[model samples]
Target: MSTQRKIVFDAIGSVTTEQYDDPHAALEPGQVRVAAKYIGICGSDLHVLAGGHPFAQPPTVPGHEICAEVTEVGPEVEGVEVGDHVVVDPIMACGHCRACLAGRYNLCEPPMVAGFRAPGFGRTSQVVPARNLHIAPRDLPWQVLAFAEPATCARHCVGRLPESARENVLVIGAGTIGLSVIQALRIMGAGQITSVDLDPTKRQLAATLGADRTFAPGELDPAETFTGVIDVVAAQATLTEACTRVVAGGTVVVMGVPSGPREIPLPSMQRFERDLVSSGMYVPSDFADAIAWLADGRFDAARLVTDVFSLEDAPKAYARAQEPDSIKVLISLSD
Candidate 1:
């Protein structure tokens, strides 16, 4: 039921780790226990480590981008069982809430998010709701399977747009989120995808993954105004420039979320004329499609995984992601 491990915090800038009781709570009727195989080092995880974001109160287990295999299942868990491979969908919500009824569970007021908002599977073992699990692709590696969550989020955003939306797309930020959005677009058959970021490492990775074109920071503004542009850079400075790039009557997906109030220009409102639509978290339909795409070999999930480290070095992994140039990085929990 309980175990001990080092709990680290502010881990992006300085070392913050300790041995604490990492518990594997009991499974509910619709739950399963998983032996975590891969725990990705994401920007949000680094936000906690660097003291830059408000994900958790610190001294908490730090992993949300996770992939694992089911080791146990509750009696009511029918679709999955022991020895089955699966990926965890970490959102926890109350079914009675209005948002839940509307199928917008991510906006649940009393939200229970895994990793940050609740207990997650990054530790040695964890019990999660069966509804939160999907049978993992037998052929996919744990490292690549871990992207299911973010990729699901991006796919949900793409699905919301009109079916007639342009095939040419632009993604700002070559970070994991940006790259994940690009991958999701590929799953949907978007004809061309362009990625832009200041970091060459990220751009290069974007090109490797699927981006048809990669542009430098300021170098991207000159490219064709996109029918759809995703803004993963949430800072006011980044948002302002991104807004300028969204074409009129086009769709600009604002996936970037930054902390604190932002400064905005009145001129930025003109982009709304471009039919701005915002999206959040994974919707069920979106997750399903992304998972199927992963299983379908439409894109190479395995190739996206560029770096892996031991759980003990998780803090270092976060540090590397925050570096000037960092690609997809993950943590292997097994000894």
Candidate 2:
């Protein structure tokens, strides 16, 4: 049997690339085999690498932002065919669940998400459900296609805001998601977009990505308010600041995964009549829109990719992803 290279985590805070015999098995019905090309490193992957993420278990592959070329399709697969480039939506919602039936699959009681709870896409070749793959523009760089997932996540965060918040938006944390939010808001024709972060590099990148202004955490006026305040870093301090700085009747969208239990000031929120919503996985429509946005060249998605590594350098890729200065790190399986 031929061998293929893959990154694997055997225990918490451990990572390694190993060559294993190719499965070379026939495609199961409704599945498509992809020659995985690029996989973007995500904060969730870093969390799992650091032994902190609750959903990820050891002895699993750890990547979700994927771009690949379809090499084979199962008998029943219809939309995807060989030679097509695509991005995979890793959200694996059980269609029969009440939340899914109600069109809120992101809120499924027992969450089953790829790269988080289920098997991930961090390998040379992978077989995924046909429904999870969305066709990509063959012309776009593989790195840009790899961003469809995170961009879809950003779309979900901004989509949850109220109509009033779309005009004047404040985004916290100029990380990948934060930068994605800036671009998404720009595409949506937002009025004023201000990004807040401690890192000057990220702040500058945010401004380039369409933020009207970029400020360090301490530079923003505590008394200043906006129609929408998105806290991408959902720690207690940031959450408190978001609730405090939001205008009365405005919306506060929490997109970050809180490190632990958080206490929201119910009295302040009630008094101001402010709205708060937590953002999670994107819906199917959001994924489609993300792919469309990338395909149409609505924004420079490639600008966000800061580093790339081969499959054998998976450990280095994760380390670079953990750096505060790094915008995006990707594993290039093909290139």
**Global Cα RMSD, each model:** 2.9, 1.4
TM-score of each: 0.87, 0.96
**Model 1: residues >4 Å from true position, as ranges?**
1-7, 10-26, 221-224, 263-272
The C-alpha local distance difference test score for the whole of candidate 2 amounts to: 0.86
What candidate 2 gets wrong by more than 4 Å, as runs, is none
* Tens-place lDDT digits, model 2, residues 226-272: 88989999999989989888888989999999988999988989998
- The CA lDDT at 270 in model 2 is 96
Pairs that collide, model 1: 6-18, 7-18, 8-16, 11-49, 12-49, 30-130
Candidate 1: RMSD to truth: 2.9
